[model samples]
Target: MAEYTTSKPEWAPEKDDENKFACGVMSGIDGITDTTVGNLNPALKNGTMKPKRKMVLSVDDYIKGVSSGDRVTLARAITLIESNNPKHFRKAQQVLQGLLPKTGKALRIGITGVPGAGKSTTIEAFGNMLCDMGHRVAVLAVDPTSSVTRGSILGDKTRMGTLSRREEAFIRPSPAGGTLGGVARKSRETMLLCEAAGYDIILVETVGVGQSETTVRSMVDFFMLIVLTGAGDELQGIKKGIMELADAIVVNKADGDNLLKAKVARAEYERMIEFIRPATEGWRTHAYLASAYKKTGLKELWDVIRAFEKVTHESGVFKRRRDSQLLDWVHSMIDEHLHNLFFDDPVVLGRMPEIREAVLKGVISPTQAVAELIHIFDVQRATQRHVDLFHPENQK
Candidate 1:
């Protein structure tokens, strides 16, 4: 005040000085200051933090993404193939056609066991070991769907936390969707998608819902049956057909108190396997003791797998198995499509309730009801074909 001059004083505040002060001189535990306040989120201030919008990609995009081993794109492709929408199906077909050349190069392994057999645990241990050895692994875990909701209760991801987070590992849990083969109806397609994505190994895990063992065996080049110690007799809940389908039977929980029991189980399984024919001509199904907790027997198990691959590949069984799988896949899809067509026809839809009641009331046999429905479906299909032939423009 005493040094007031004609020119404005240097201490005079500007028009927006109050705002600057509020930003820079906020109270703190130590003291207030006249320092410039910086943005906590610089990206947000610069409009760089906005999330990218997800868009439906084209077939070319999918092919590029999968070929480049992009996990996000690979996941999107799998979802598209698994979708129930007709449009998604068409798009997926295009994507698959484009990626076909890159597929059929991965080793497909099917893993299954009865409920509570530590199947997921063993797979996690084994899969991570393979990943550590520099192999990219993809796990297609098929969870059983709720009969009422037809939705999956996905829990495999949680069980395989470590492996699921690995950059070289991919885990997909698909709903079984009431598909009888113990796997999702689209599992074969999904495996091919994984193969196209450059994974070295594909693990197709089943729901272990009995009767799925054979189905998985048909699809995978190698089939591993995991069993637990002290789970009762050698063939307790597992069917004889399952033992016959196994390329290798591993007795899990082979550490701690269960060590001796696991060894006993292994011998018993070995004896049981001897009575059955080998899953492949040159390969003999043997039982091995494993401890998923301690991570023992994993390397040996992998060695066995590599040996089996080498032997089968040289003997031509590997190629033949894949060819047979393709045929099975084609027939399975055809059966599914025909079944869907028969049930989804408008004529059949309208008559289904009435037919069900008639069959339940004993007025018509189940076979007669099916024949009647099929007949309706055939008529409808024939009428549609006739219309398409006469009115070609209306086909689309």
Candidate 2:
């Protein structure tokens, strides 16, 4: 076979057009340049082993595969949903629209706690128990992004080793991506995908920073806060507003010597609950004791969740919360979209460097800097619509 060959494309206008056109002939390369890595890309030398093209799932395929509970396809569909690519965003939204009817069936629960509070351990135990009882559980951990590496470092699969292997369980760890919420920006969509995949229980584990987890509370039907036995954290939790947000306050690690202390901590939390308004209208928040290691109280915890679902559903609070969540989702997405547009706008980007330097040098106050940036962003946006933010005639 000839190592290299050249032929003008049929689409070329004429032989004379080759001299003027940049794209005329399809030049067959002999091989990669010696400067390139021959060891890594040996296929380029012989051209026998071509790189395989990616397998793309169509919208209908994604919908069918997700609905039929194909784990691999479901995982791939979730990857598509979490993708940052513009093209993927459109495809993902289409897939969600197709699967919309299949979603919203699962009971979504959000769990958060202070650091080292054994949230993962409890979730694993709880999830395994649910799996054994004929329930499908999906555990989603929203890991915090490293400010330096900007990567998701928390390994949920490794932490939930037992549950991850279960056929009835699906565990996905999502990065917060600097979103203020302890949950990922696309977590609501991910939860829907889990529901569509036949998972009846969706457990959302937040970044667990305590306060910011309120965002998680908005998406979940039930929100619970896990706290430790001591370290004066019970009072700290109340001060952080997390206690107010929680439908249940669980004092985990109630075993061995800590059992007595755990009971005391629960009493303190129960006392604090009396001063705070209930998280739900028709529900009262209460503190409970549990031990993840011994697997006690988990069954009771599930019973409480089940009872909450029944009570909220009957009282119409469940539907109202879901409806309110939908509205909040819309408002949040709009805020994020407009935020991205403003910061990425060419005019804003051009002026930001100078304004930032001025603020850093104390030449302008932070408030003044923000006002200037907002003005610039608004003016730039108005110009696109053939209007001016400060035209005298328009102002009148």
Candidate 3:
């Protein structure tokens, strides 16, 4: 029942707040007048008020909604954050700008391990413990996007049913989009939004496949690697990259007959930690045995996280790491954006079909096609430069 004013399109802005317009109940357009607007049936307006197409939620609206604890708005904000559209990308940045200062207070933890390591179950138990201690938690689970369909399984909700249903917890499963980043493109923005929304703990769960472990390590304050026992090749198969990044190694499923093997794995991980240089200052990575299914040893894990948080927060290293991560993110985003722009040029797009036809016809090799495309772009730029030089407006 609340009426909200709609801002101009992302491409334009009004001169003053007074010129800002309200979203019509039916049409998302702002300029409809009393004569024309009233002529439209009220029922048509009510039936056609589609939020998805007409007006995408701005970052300001998203932050306001989340801060006010509106779950539907929060979900929509995450969707906008994950969108790949150029306009959505710009809007997402606006949202992050407003939310960044309110963030950095939460403990950002990244957790990864091989499939079947009970990662979700561990997160549920760990999240429940934090909630019991009166902390609000947000979990970001990264699922691999289907290469064929470009969709994700989104099974985190089903796997962490109990924790997902918690009032104080928010669970979001994001598609990796085959980037090898082990997270959705906008996960960092989502993290800031979650922290701004008053979550004291932010857990990022990534698929434990090889290079993704390294990606997860670069983004979090603390990295926890979960593992399971009874896999005889555990130590041998565990990559050095994953082992080196782990701030804490948790051998989950340690209850019942798995207890002995879990202890053995824990000791092995401890020894492994000793060989790798500690990743953080004044923090010694440790390993523990736990059973997420049985809800045992979760308290110890929380204690370890709390200890790490306290030390990092006091030393000021946490803030430095976040700043460094932001720099890295900026550089990466710039490179990706420019790369997309170059490839998405109309000149490039128009030539793609011709290039493909040449390749199909065996008239040009793939490498030759690339060379020809580059040559075409170079020639086009040269012609544009000539035209500009000839124009009197270019004299300046």
Please list the C-alpha lDDT of all candidates, in the order they appear. 0.81, 0.83, 0.76
Winning candidate number (TM-score): 1
Regarding lDDT, does 2 or 3 come out ahead? 2
Residue-level lDDT tens digits of model 3 in 304-371: 98899889889998888889998988898777655655576678779989899999999999999998
List clashing residue pairs in candidate 3.
Answer: none
Candidates, ranked, lDDT: 2, 1, 3
Model 1 CA lDDT for position 211: 68
Residue-wise C-alpha lDDT for candidate 1, range 1-396, written one tens digit per residue:
022123333565666555444333222222212111111233433467863523447778889999999998898888878877555666678788889998999999998887888889988999999999999999999888999998887888789999999999999988888877668777888888899988989998899876657778878999998888776746753454787788999898899989998898888887787688888888988999899999999999999999999999999999988898899888987777666666667778899999999999999999999888877777457456334322535322
Ranking of candidates on TM-score, top first = 1, 2, 3
True lDDT of residue 87, candidate 2 = 55
Clashes of 1: 0
Give candidate 3's TM-score.
Answer: 0.77
The superposed Cα distance between candidate 2 and the true structure at residue 341, in angstroms, equals 1.2
The true-versus-predicted C-alpha distance at residue 46 of model 1, in Å, is 17
What does the lDDT read for residue 114 in candidate 1?
79
* Candidate 2 Cα misplacement greater than 4 A, ranges: 1-54, 362-367, 378-396
Candidate 3 root-mean-square deviation in Å:
11.4
Highest lDDT scorer:
2
Candidate 2 global CA lDDT score: 0.83
Q: Give the CA lDDT, 0 to 100, for residue 61 in model 2.
A: 83
